[model samples]
Target: MPYTTAPVLPPGTLSRSPQPVLPTGDGLVLRPWRGRDVAAVHEAFQDPLMHQWHIRRSDSEAEVAGWIEGWEKEWEGERDAQWAVVDADSDRLLGRVALRSIHLVDGLAKVAYWTTAAARGQGVATRATATLTRWAFEEIGFHRLELLHAVANEPSCRVAEKAGFALEGVKRSAALHQDGWHDMHLHGRVRGD
Candidate 1:
C-alpha cells in the first residue's frame, strides 16, 4: 500500500552522476578511493586509535583492496559515498570521509570520517566533513545529514561540531566497540544549517 508523499529524492539520484572529487579549500581534497590507496588505508586501520572507534583494522593489503571495492560498489548502488581525503598538492592520503547509511527516499545520510595520525591537528576531518556536507546539500540535494560518535570519542565530537552539525541528543549504548557498548552522541545538520 503506497499511501505517502513522493520520495524526497528519486532512485538513481546519485548513481546517475559519477562520484565527484571535492575540494575542501583548506589545502585538502576529497577524492574517490583508488587501488593505490590500499597502503594508506591499511596503515590507517592499523592505528590503535582508529581501531578504538572504528573497531576494525586491516591486517593485509588484500583486505584493504576488498574494502575499496566495497566502497566502489556502494557508490554505484547509490547507498553510500566514500572519499579519500588527501593533500591537494601532494595527493597523499590524509584520511577518509563518507556519507553512510544513505536513505535517498528521505534525502538523508549519516556522515562519518577519520584522519590519519599525520593528519591529526591539521583540521582534516573537520574541513573534509564541511566540504562533503556542502556538496550533499547543495549539489546532491540531500535534506539532512547526521553525524554520530561514541561519547568517549571526543575528537570526533569536536569534528562534528566544527563541521556545523548541531548536537541533538545522546543515544544510550548506541555503539559497540571492542571494549564494550558506548553511549553515542547524535548530531544533525539540515540543508540550510
Candidate 2:
C-alpha cells in the first residue's frame, strides 16, 4: 500500500505562539518563567522528592538561570512548552508543568510536572496537569498525550490519575534517576479520552 502521511495539526491549526499566561480558573495560572523566578526555582528544587526523581537540579543561581534560558529557547524552537505554575493572587511559583519530547509529525507529546514541598498535598500538580492537558489537546492540536513517572513515586501516580491519564502499565528499569535504575509507570490520554 502506498504510504499516506497523517496530518499532525488539524487543517488550519497552527503551532503554539507562546502565551504569557494560561489561567486554570481557580486561582492557578501557568506562565512563562522569568529571570526573577530563579530564587523560587532554587527553593523548590530543595525538596527531597525533587532531588530523587529529577537528578539535574540546579544547585546554584547561575545554573537555574541557564535552565530558564534553555526553556525559552525550547519555546522558540517549538520543541517544548515549559510553564511556571503560579498562584494567581500572589503570583508565587508553585511548580512547573511542561510538554516535552513533542513529536509534531505524530501529534504526540509527553507531560511532566512537579510541585514545591509547600504545594505538594494541595493538588498543585494535579491541577497543573489537568490544565495543561486541556490546552495541549485543544489548542496545540495534540492527538495523544502521555505522562510517565517512577513507579516508586506514588504522589506522581496520583497526580496522573486525577488528571484523567489512564494507567498504561509499566516499563521496567526504564529510567535512570538519582538512585539508579527505576521502573516507570506509563499513563496516557488521547483527544476526547
Candidate 3:
C-alpha cells in the first residue's frame, strides 16, 4: 500500500541558526543539551509516565551517555539539534527539547520534547515548544514544523496546541505501542515566510 506524504516546504528554504541561542521564558532556559545534562536526563526518564510514553531503552548511565553523544554527533553533522530545558536562574535541567527528523531539502522538521514530572503543568513544555518553534521558523528558516503524539497523550497534545500547531489529523494505527496499534495525532505549523 502506498503512503500519503505530508506537504513539504520549498527546497533550500530553511537555514540553520547562525549561532546557538539561549531562549528564556517563564523562568526556563532553552539551550543546547550538554554532557552535564546526562544525570538530569536520566532522572527525568525515570518518571513512570516518561518511561511509558517515550523511553525505548533501559535508563542506564551508559544509555544516557550514549544519548548525549548521539545529540553531539547530530549537532556536529548539522542534521539535527537538541536543547536542554533548565531553570533560568539556577540552570537546573528541567527536561529536553529537540528538532529532529530534519529535512533541509524540504525545509521541514519535527519537534519533540519532554519535561520532568515535577515540571509538568507549570508551562515548561508549552513555553519551550513555543520558543523552539519560533526559533526553528525564524532563526533557522524552517517553513514547516510538525509534532506527533500518541492519541492517549493529552498533555502532549495540549502543549502542541498551545504552541500554535494546528491539528492536521490522525493516522490510524500509525504507532505500535506496547498495548497494541494506536492512533497518532499529527500537528503542524507553517511559517508565514
| TM-score (all chains, Cα) for each model | 0.98, 0.93, 0.87
Clashing pairs in 3: none
Q: Could you report the Cα RMSD, in angstroms, for every candidate shown? A: 0.9, 2.3, 4.4
Task: Name the regions of candidate 2 deviating beyond 4 angstroms.
Answer: 1-3, 10-16
- Between 2 and 3, whose lDDT is larger? 2
**Which residue pairs show backbone clashes in model 1?**
none
Tens-digit lDDT string for candidate 2 (47-142): 787889886777888889999988877776666779999999999999999999877778888999988888879988899999999988887779
**Candidate 1 vs candidate 3, lDDT winner:** 1
Winner on lDDT between 1 and 2 is 1
lDDT of each: 0.92, 0.87, 0.79
Candidates sorted by lDDT, best first: 1, 2, 3
**Residue by residue across 100-188, what tens digits does model 1's lDDT show?**
99999899999999999889988999999999999999988999999999999898999999999999999999888999999999999
* Candidate 3 backbone clash number: 0
Better of 2 and 3 by TM-score: 2
In terms of lDDT, the poorest run of 10 residues in model 3 is 10-19
Please tell me which model should have the higher TM-score, number 1 or number 3. 1
**Alpha-carbon error at 100 in model 3, in Å?**
1.0
lDDT: worst 10-residue window of model 1: 1-10
Best prediction by TM-score? 1
